[model samples]
Structures are given as structure tokens and as C-alpha cells.
Target: MKETTGFREKVVIITGASSGIGKAVSLQLASEGACVSLAARNAERLQEIAQECNQLGGSAIAIPTDIADQQQCRNLITKTVEKFGRIDMLVNNAGFTVVDKFEDLQTLELFQRVMNVNFNGAVQCTYFALPHLKNTHGRIVNISSLGGIVPFPGNASYAASKAAMTGFSDSLRLELQDDQVSVTMIYPGAVVTKFQEHRLDKDGQVRGSDGGSLYTEDMMTADECAEIIIEAAKQRKREVVMKPGKISRWIKLISPSLLDKIIIERVKKIIEREAQESK
Candidate 1:
């Protein structure tokens, strides 16, 4: 890999900036003096993060947006450019999913909802931000998931959306190769965050938003995940699937049947937990 320019005074737009990896990435970049444009539906929290970023030594602005809406996506980019003059990075980190078997979903619209934010939203934001990114020779760090490449049981809707993202990012990378807008895809494993708590109910409403991590075991912190992400973006790496996620992808390609057995066991445990929670 070649040595890359760092994020100092570079303008960046991060979706899902109210929590988790997006928030972590925002703070890290702020500490390094990157102008960050924060976007999320949570307007209050978004403003709070923007303030924190400014105090941390970077210029920051909160742009409340629901990326699933095409007009909101455009507004996010437009506002960022209006504030910062140019954009150097667009981090497509906004996504959500329901925790249930595919067949158990109440409506097919549930899947469409997930795809809207996880895949189409990112594409929409990119569509509006691309012209600015091209002007600055910017980077597009797409926060994908391990599920994008592997089959994650009980959340195939989420997996399908991320798979679409993976395919889009790769093709976009090739298309923009000569334009100098680097595309970096990140496939992360589990991380500790409020995201786990917000499982969508069968009615398509968010659940457990004020709850704890869904997983029982210890997991990587959002800060740690952000550190890895920022480093990869700074280095402009082609793509990153860290550690066990890397192993999972390899196993998926070589022994899919073996992987399916593992997923079935995991899904059984998840089902058991959901039953207990319902009780």
C-alpha cells in the first residue's frame, strides 16, 4: 500500500452520526482536525456530537437527515458543502435491521425498509456527493458488514441489503479508478453499541432502543472499531474485513455447508433468547 494523506482539515460527511461506529469515527476525525458534517435522524444527539467535535478541535455541523429519503440525502450533502466549501470523504455508515427469521417478518416492506437505508440511502448520498468528491479526489468509506459476504441467520434481510452494498462499492471502485476517488469497504464483526438494542419488531417499529447489548459475551468497543476504520480510510485501503470476519469469508467460500451448521446453532440460541425476552 502507498502512503496516503491524512485527514487534517478535510471535509467529511458521516451518516448515522448519533451513535455507534459513526459517532466514534466522528470524534476520532475531530481530534485530528477534520471538518465533520454529522447526519442522522436524531437531531438532538447529532447537535451534541457536532458540539463535541468542535470542542475536540475540528469544525463540525449537525445535519439532521433520514438517509432513506432521497431529498434528505441530497440535503445532507448540500448542507455539508455549504458549510465546508468541499467534501473529501463520505462515510456511508447508516443502517439498521430487524432480528427475526426471514419468514417471520410481518410485511415484505420490512425488507424494503432495511434496503432503503442500508443500500439505496448510501447510493443516494453518493450520487449527490460524488461531484464534490471528484473535485477533491476524495474517498468513500462504505461501512459494510461481515454479513454482506457471509450468510447470517435470522437476519437475511440485513444480509441481503449489505450484499447489495458490497456489489455496488466494488463496481463503483472500478468505475472511479481513473477519477482518484478511492472506495474503501469495511466488513465489521460484532461491536458493542446501542445498535444491538434497537431490533425492529414485527410491526416494523424499533424495539429495545433504550436497552443493553443483545449479545451476552464481551465484544469490541465502537472506539476500537472506529480506530481500525479511520486508519483504513487514511491509508485508502481497497477493503477491510478484519480478523474473524476475514476467516468467516474464507470458510464461506470453501465450506458453505459447514458454515450453515454453525449459523443454525447460533440462530437457535438467538431464538431461545428472543423467547425468553418475550416472556
Candidate 2:
């Protein structure tokens, strides 16, 4: 396992730092002595996390930001630079998803919203932070999802947005290769987090189902996911996949149809179980 001790005094800006994987990453990096900048729409939560970072013997500042807005994205980078003098790493982790099937919805607005937050937000932040990152020979860590690589049935918009993130990260990595900047894309499977509770439905309301049982027994914890990300950063790895075994990845690469069949069967089982329990 790669050690996070190398992060001492590093300046890392993490979007979506109010909770879930983002929050875990912030705390872990802070504990490793990184000066963390916590960004999220929730000011109170960000401040709370900032306090925790300080308590953990690392410096932190809270910057309330809605990454969906381009200006806010720019401001986040600007504030981080002003406070920390340079950006050693930029973690684009801000994103949300709607829980309904794409065909169950009529409007493109929700899809656009997902793209705005998941893809465009990262693009804008990267644009603003690139100069500072170039100066420091920094790193970019994008928190994409397994859904991006292997599409899910009820999460078309979310999957599409994450797929865009994966593509963007790949291209950006190649472009920055000669500049001493590294780009690492993370494809995480199901993780224990508050993400389900915060997701929206097709109508733009908070999802009605609790989604607790939707996770597999082997789901990773948010802290575990964070640790993987930190290790990737430390090693400047090109990519990381959080699947249980390498077979799944190989299946996708060699025969996507086979992968899709497996996913379909798994999803069918889940739906059947949910339907039976609803009775």
C-alpha cells in the first residue's frame, strides 16, 4: 500500500467535501498533513469539516461552492490559490444523480443538470486550476464511477455524465503528460455513503426509496474508497478500478455484451427481490 505521508504540506482542493467519499478524502489527506480546501454547496457542513481537519493537525479552509455554476467553479480555484499559494492537487468529486430510468422521464433538463455538475463542473475547475497546477507539477484526481464504464439500467443520465468524465480525464492525462501534471481517474463500485439519500428522482425531488438494500454485501466503505484515491495520488497512477475482481474489468474489455448480460441478470435479481419485499 502506498503511504499518504508524502502528502505533508501538499495543498489539495476537494469539491463535494461536505460528505461521502469527498469528506473521507478530505479528512484522510488532512490527517496526512495536507492543507485541504473543502468545497461544497453546504457551508455549515464545510465549516464543520474544516474544524475536523484542524483538529486532525492539518490546515483547512471551507469554501461554499456550487460547482454547477461556472463562475463558482472559477471562484473555488481562485480562493484555494489565494489561501494556499498553490494547488498541489485538484479533486473533482462533486456530482449527484437522479434515481429514475431515463425512459421514465421526459425532460432533458435533469440530464443536463447531471452533466453540468459531473462533467462541466470539472472542466471549468480544471481550466481555472491548470495554470497553478502546471506551476506545481500537480495532480488531478477525478472521482468517476463504475457506472461510467459499465452502464446501469436506471441511471442513464448519471452513467453518461460519468462516461464523459472518464473520457475527459483520459484525454487530459495524455495532454498533460509532458507538463509534469498527472491525471488519475477512479472508477468506484458501490460504496457505503449518504449518496442515495441525497439523490433526486425524475421529478427533481429527493428520491423516495431509501436504497440501503440496493448495495451489495461486498460494498466498500467511504473511507476505503478515500484511501484508494489517496494511494493513487501518492503514486500518480493513471487509473484505479474498485471492482471486487479483475475478471469484471477483463469481461468489459474483451466482451462488453457478456458484461452487460451479467449486469442485467444482477439488476433483474435486485428488482425481483425489491418487488417481492414490497408485497
Candidate 3:
């Protein structure tokens, strides 16, 4: 028998499809002849990506959706099924973050806001798409982060939301095992995207485009990250953890104190930098 993951002409619904990993995934799958439903809060950007996907040889439709909204999540699934007839995959890639000292006296609304989009949003979409996915014996690929596995500083809410996803994906895989609906969890280290630029500040203000440039670099690109996710979904793998996250998980298991010390030092530098910026 030929080993075909049956990718061609497969129906895939990707959230956070406006940019970054989601956009990259949409284009790649489109090029491979998948019918992709692009969902995101940005209607204009979603349309642009959908157009690009269609031109790349895949059928594509843009459904402006906010996954955080349950009705919209339902609409995303409904619209995709209506257009494509069936769903082969659901990629939960939408994310939100807020950068601030955990002890800052700022309004703690950032936690709920981040959770709404990151965790709750993914949950909503997954729940709505599960029925469709079960019927097709499809796949659910979550775009988690390395921060979810190992402790990280500066973005508590984002990390917690991703951690929630890590746990959710694990349990969901077992629950859906009998249904033959595979769940693939991806823990990418750090992908170069508009993630930081869109992050909220301590006061819940947008950090703007310059936010990501100041923090870090030398990381994987969105296109590279998308490739890994696409392959993992195709294989229906249990989990795909990146190299750095794997090393950190090993270090944590071997010597938790050492990992704690490392995290503390990094947090110290982050605090010092924030102090300087605030002055």
C-alpha cells in the first residue's frame, strides 16, 4: 500500500491565520493542494492570506473569526464544513501574551485577557471541531510553546495558558483515542513572529512593532516552525517537542535547583532591564 498521509485536497481549518505560523501553515498546506479555512480576528489580513493560498494551488476561504468567541468558533467550523464538505485537520495556533513583572502593581486583567485568547480560544475551537474531526478521523494540532514545559520569566500569563494547553492536549489524545482522532501537540522553542510586537504591556497597552526586536533573536522563523507543524500533523505524531525545550525538560528532571537558579538569574536580568526602561 502506498504511504499517503492523504494530504492532498484535505480540508484544514487554521486559526490565527492572519500572520506568523498560522499564515505560513496555510500557505504550505495550500501549496500541497489542501482546502484551507483561514480564521482570525483580522478580516483583511485573513482575506489576503486566503488569496495567496488559492494562488499557491490550494483551495482557500477566509472566515474572519475570533476563536475566543464561542459563536465565532462554531461559525468557523460550520463555515468550513459548508464550503469544503469535511474537515481533515484543525490547527489551533492563535496566541496572545502580555509582558510584565509578575509582581507589578498593574491591573491583573492581563491574565484573563491572555487566557481568553490563548487557552480558552483554543478550547472553544477544538470543542466545536471535534465532532467534525471525529467523523473524518482527522487530526488536531496545537501550537504550544517551550515556555509551557519549562519555567520562563516576563510572560507569566502566556506561559500559563500554554501550560494549560499542554495538559489539555495530553488528556484529549487519550479521550479521542477510540475515535481515531489523533491529537498532535507541538512545543516550538521560539519562532520569529509578530508575537512580541502584539504583546500587551503591564498596563494592558500594546507594545507595538518594536517590542520583539528588543528582547531576542537567533530563533526559528515562522516558515520553519510551520514546516515542523505540518509534518507532525501529517504523521499524526503524539508530540513534537523542540530541541531547547527537550534539553530544559531534561535539566529540570536532573537538577531542579539548578534550573531554578538559572531561571532566577534570567529573571534578575529581566527585572534590571525593566527598571532601566522605566526610568
lDDT of 3 by residue, 1-279 (tens): 112394789999999999999999999999999999999999999998999999999999999998888999999999999999999999999997887778882766778888898999999999999999999999999998888888577778988999999899999999998999999999998788888788887888887876665455677999999998998888888889996887788889999889889888977886687677767
Residue 181 local lDDT, model 2: 91
Candidate 2's TM-score: 0.94
Which pairs, if any, clash in model 3? none
Q: Least accurate stretch of 10 residues (summed lDDT) in model 1?
A: 209-218
Tens digit of per-residue lDDT, candidate 2, span 1-279: 223338899999999999999999999999989999999999999999999999997899999999999899889998888999999999999888887888777798998999999999999989999999999888999999988878779899899999999889989988998888999999888888888778888888985456565666678999999999999988888889887435787998999899889989988998898787667
Whichever of 1 and 3 has more lDDT, that candidate is: 1
Shift of residue 192 alpha carbon in model 2, Å:
0.4
How do the residues 71-172 of candidate 1 rate in per-residue lDDT, one tens digit apiece?
Answer: 999999999998899999999999988767788887798888889999999999999999999999899999998888776777888999899998999999
Residue 17, candidate 1: alpha-carbon lDDT: 91
lDDT of 2 at 60: 100
Judging by TM-score, tell me the better candidate of 1 and 3.
1
Alpha-carbon RMSD, each predicted model: 1.8, 2.2, 2.5
Q: Is candidate 2 or candidate 3 better by lDDT?
A: 2
